[model samples]
Target: MSYELQALIGPAELVAVAAAEVPAARPRLLAQGLALIPATPEFLAAFRVGDEATAAPAAAVSPSGTAASAGFDWFPGGLERRLAAWSKAGPIACVEADYFGGTGTQRAAVWADGRLDLGPITSAELEPFPPEGSPISRALRRLGARVTEGDDAVRDEFDAVGLGAHRATVSWVSAG
Candidate 1:
């Protein structure tokens, strides 16, 4: 099954905390890391398409599965972590999280310090919005980051197990 989460935070400082806190729990809890994506929109988009040629394949998933030929799983939480930091520097149009797998798919989008117009979203009618003054929403704004919706990366690693995105965690090491 797929799993996704998104949040927005502000005032800068807390971004680091969220980065360390959110992703750290997941991969460590599952004992499996996820594929890493760069913070830039272009890179993020290329990652979705499994277009390593254009994007930085820093810690990319292998074609086979989560187990890199070298035996390491790239952490998926990096994107979230990066956004947490990036947003602190400027006003981001949006923040998002996404996951797509054979069993299911998940996506989240968020906006902080501004109102979100749900009319344009893909599943806007079916989507849920955080109420104003809600603790979570407030906390995120205070932290300088907010979670939001987005789409899942393309399924590249067909041999992956469990969640599809997990497959992108796979890597292959070259031996000299």
Candidate 2:
């Protein structure tokens, strides 16, 4: 009985699991979050989004139980709210020298029965382009940032590069 978790990365990309077959939502959501972080900025920002936009958006997992688009922006405001919701929660506090769109804000989402949701992401919208050669990564590369992927279990070292800096590693545990 596993459910998919769709995490919003940057403004455009959505690291989503379209009905992955996991045993529980917590590990699956957390794993999906780490797995979905765009290794590069272009991946960070891909696809277009419309805030206040509405449609029957599926929560990342497709009807066929597969990752719906390498990312899912299937609904309107679908992408923006995801990012905004997480930011607003304050549980996922993010403070960085550089962030996408030059700034960020936060709010809250409702969760129940082992499912979590946040949205109508406060003015949260997609970046409108792919995150290729983004300002943040390009700078980090110049500073010789030792980047790697996997090992998402270690919170403090799996952060992504955005805005003007790399995340100072994260240590997160789901309340679920």
Candidate 2 lDDT over 19-92, as tens digits, reads 12111212212222222232122222332223222334444322432222212333223333343344342222
Clashes of each: 23, 14
Query: Which portions of model 1 miss their true places by more than 4 Å?
Result: 1-14, 17-105, 112-176
The TM-score values for the models, in the order shown, are 0.21, 0.21
Q: Give the Cα-based TM-score of candidate 2 against the true structure.
A: 0.21
lDDT of 1 by residue, 55-145 (tens): 3342453333211212122223233234434544543222223445533222223323333211112222234534442222333333333
List the candidate 2 regions with Cα displacement exceeding 4 Å: 1-7, 10-52, 56-75, 90-133, 136-176
Name the lDDT of candidate 1: 0.29
lDDT (CA) per prediction: 0.29, 0.27
